[model samples]
Target: MATKEEDVKLLGFWASPFSRRVEIALKFKGVSYEYLEQDIFNKSALLLELNPVFKMVPVLVHKGKILAESLLILEYIDQTWKNNPILPQDPYEKAMARLWAKFVDEQVGPVCFKSVVKADKGIDVAIEEAQELITFLEKELSGKDFFGGKTIGFLDMVAGSMIPFCVARAWEGMGIDMIPEEKFPELNRWIKNLNDIEIVRECIPQREKQIEHMMKVAERIKLA
Candidate 1:
């Protein structure tokens, strides 16, 4: 449990899924904190001071100590507030969760952007890679409401950041079906399950807003 005197502050960008991951974890843990929205284009002195190396958004400041990286922030939140634990108790399961979380963070962008946005690299290759990733997740989510089985857990939160936000909106912006109902039924179901959760849904940016942003990005890529 967080002490009353311990101040928790989150420096984040509004549309960043990485930042949203930390927000979801904090909300899930029922930890009260201050949220300082940052303008990444014009970096703030506070953000630079806290995250000197990366100077990025989604910096978690707890009782004067600063933590960077979304996954690490999530872990810190879980550890700080023992209630509503996110990671699994079993060591092996925890390791698996961390592995998938890292995979989602590293791969989701390239796989999603290349598939939907016009690029020198063909969309076919990106589609194949995206399908491979989705298939793995489908198998993992088989017979489970979430990656955590009954409830949302660490992997669920991490995967949730990518799936319905960037990937889904990218496909929508392209007017093509990537995760079709017939092809990725299990994965689609899992997406719905995650979205239905109030905490996840509340923090998610509006779908229309995401689509508009993605279209602008795609246009920029084309112009470049």
Candidate 2:
């Protein structure tokens, strides 16, 4: 019998954009792998053993090696498979992809989510913070179809869940407009572009499902 990592396997959660980034990267590269859905709120022994320090999803196993962190897994997937490269080839472009991907994941995404939840409580301050964080991406996306440029690339996959995916559903659930076209035209245009991509549409969780899940998350955040 083949060893556990003799073939590719991804331990992930459906609602987690981090792991979804890995899944999208794999799909882009046309790599075959097994998908294991994890209940991160209730960590499994395997997940604990595989990633004791962080105990996070998006843990990738390939050729018996365990890789943690969604961005790291994305890099590994791109390098491991040459076809349909995710990161750009140019040195500067590749660096920018990594930078923006990191920024969206670490900075922009959190603020956006918090803003959505807080906006429901009649708090406009969080919206201001969200706009401030989003302005960086708005300027960066100027005159570009994607952060990765013409085609969806590494940064696109990383920010996939946060932007159009989460923002679209979250804003609808809150019954408010966030990132209006007049204000963030580039980002809105980017959202339209992403919506037109079949694979992107397929990869994201359903809109109603995401909205329900995000509302549940909002409740938790309120308690916290």
Candidate 3:
């Protein structure tokens, strides 16, 4: 296990899935650090100092060196600790794991954005694409407790962040529960299983908070 290092810090926002991804990676790897919550809507001096270009949260500061981007931060955390390896050792498996991560990164943002807009045509298209993504996950998750098999891996961390937020937000807005008890039993089981894990349970933000955040965002979009 990697011992806690001095000056290890996370610049993140509570509601950001990007930030949660890195936070979950740190918890999973048993790394200890300080967390500074940033408001992306109101960019902080610290956030600007860390990531001037993107001006985003989730800047990982370690021993004075700064890293941005959640996936890259996750990789850095995995490599730095040398314990609780999230990616598999085998080259092929590792490749597969990365593929899933990339797929989620490219797809989930647009899907969630459209879902929140509550537009009939846009939401219909978004729902169709979202269903395809879920179907793909269902196939990937077939006969496996996790994408990394018995253990929660890199892909698991990314997926975990989104599903909980999606479940919380969608239920409130659309009244369409994505992770229904009937459909997606395997994925539902995985979500519940993850909820039971100590690290996952601890890192997960409250559902009420997420719902509130989503409501605010939706309201803002309505006015603008």
RMSD of each: 2.0, 3.1, 2.0
Distance from true position, residue 159, model 3, in Å? 0.9
lDDT of every predicted structure (CA atoms): 0.83, 0.82, 0.78
Q: Candidate 3: where is the Cα deviation over 4 Å?
A: 120-126, 166-168, 221-224
Writing each residue's lDDT as its tens digit, candidate 2 over 122-188 gives 5577677777888998898899998888888998888776677776567667775778899999988
**Rank order (by lDDT, best first):** 1, 2, 3
Global local distance difference test of model 3 = 0.78
Error of 1 at 52 (Å): 1.6
Tens-digit per-residue lDDT, 26-97, candidate 3: 888888889998878989988998899889978999988999998889888888988879989999998888
TM-score ranking, best first? 1, 3, 2
- Candidate 1 lDDT by residue in tens digits, 34-152: 88999987999999999999989899988888899999988988888899889998999999999988877777665656555764567777677677877778888889999988899
| Model 1 lowest lDDT segment of ten | 111-120
C-alpha lDDT of residue 19 in model 1 = 88
Clashing pairs in 3: none
For model 2, name the residue pairs that clash: none
